[model samples]
Target: MEEIFDECWNSKGIQVFVKRDDLIHPIISGNKWRKLKNYIQTFSLNEHSGILSFGGAYSNHLFALAFVGHSLRIPTVGIVRGEELIITSNPYLNQMNDWGMRLHFVARSLYRDKEIPSEYENYLCIPEGGYGSQAIDGMDNLVHELPSCDAIYCAIGTGATAIGIARATSVLVTGILTLNNRAEIEDHLKDFPAANLKLDDKYIFGKYAKSNADLETFCRDFYEKHQIAIEPIYTGRMFYALVDHIKNGHIAPDSKLVAIHTGGIK
Candidate 1:
């Protein structure tokens, strides 16, 4: 955890700190590492033929998993969400391929089934965004590393990270939703106490992977001011929401808040 003393926070009479989970690793950083920890530990490389997971074209989950598979010498398959990515080559997909993760593009419809095709049934199947019972255990580990605060904030994709943190700690967990609806997140976190969790969808900036000029400008200015780079998909939206909450008096005066930098800048 790193304390960032900015005049913006001082003006609001709030103390702000960022948990630098992004610096945990170069590739498998932030919540990605936390979410994948138990799964990787439980499954032995020799026991399984390969590992299979689901994600979109620009998914940080796929990107991190590719590097993980390469480092562990495990054969990996990424069930890509869009079939168009097969013909269109981009840096993210190219890097996943280079890292030895076999790309299997599927139509968006079939991807929703969340099951490995019969041919790859033998491989270990990991859910989209790494949400599972094991993921909660893995993410619960993050609570131990965090400092006591009035509230904790993080970007919510699958809600696994926020739910895990909420379950493990008494601090109010504010999850800035990167998606359009909170229904999916609410469903995933149904087992947890609702009073401990707060979900906000106001900072999505249109939709996942979509950004506008204001968001871009804010990220640029934030980097110049704090020297911490945040991408639009996760961290940028999270910080944007945090600042907005503080400025609008949503966060109580003099309250300490810790924002989890969930990485995936690339």
Candidate 2:
């Protein structure tokens, strides 16, 4: 946890600190590792052949999986979404291929169903973005590591990280939605206490991974002033929402907040 003293928030009498989960690893950083850790640990007990997962061409999940598979000598397979894409489609795709993950691209329609090939059925297949109960344990682990604060904020992608934190802790968890999946997130988190988690979609700007000039500028100024690395896709939107809330007086004065930095591997 790193406390950042910004004059804007400081002047407003709000305190901000960053939980650098990105420092967990270079590739399998932040929630990536947290969400996948359980699956990897129990792989040996299962009768599956290897670890297989689904993702896009530039998926950080597949990228991290490939590296983990390489380092641990565990066989891995990636089901890419776009049929037109291949190992050479992007540098990250190329790297995943080079790390020994067998890549198979399929039609987007079929990818939406997340179906594994009959041949790979024996492989332990994880859902897209690691959206399952497996991630809850990992997020619980993260909750144990966090400091006490009035509220905690994190970016919402698959909703696993935020939901897990919300379920495990009484601290207010605000998940800034990066994608238009509020309904899905609400559905998944319906069983948890509603007050523990709050979903905010105002910072999405347009949609997942979409960014404008203002967001880019904020990221640049953030790095310049705070010396913390953030991208517009995930952590940037989350932190931006935090500051915006502070400035907008959404938070009470003298309140301290924790913003999770959910790393970038793409």
lDDT of candidates 1 onward, in order: 0.86, 0.89
- Residue 179 error for model 2, in Å? 0.7
For model 1, where is the 10-residue window of minimal lDDT? 186-195
Which residue pairs clash within candidate 1? none
Please identify model 1 stretches exceeding 4 Å from their true place. Answer: none
lDDT for each residue of candidate 1 in 1-266, tens digit (9 for 90 to 100): 88887777788679998999999898899989999989899988667788899998888898899999999898899999886777247888888999999999988888888768788888998899898888878877788988889999999998888888888888898999988868888777666555688889999888787857888888898899888889877888899999998878798788999999988836
lDDT of 1: 0.86
User: How far does residue 163 in candidate 2 sit from its true spot (Å)?
Assistant: 0.4
- Compute each candidate's TM-score over C-alphas: 0.96, 0.96
**Model 1 residue 20 distance off true place after TM-score fit, in angstroms:** 0.3
Clashes of each: 0, 0
Q: Give model 2 RMSD, 1 decimal.
A: 1.3
lDDT of 2 at 133: 86
Compared with the true structure, model 2 gives a TM-score of: 0.96
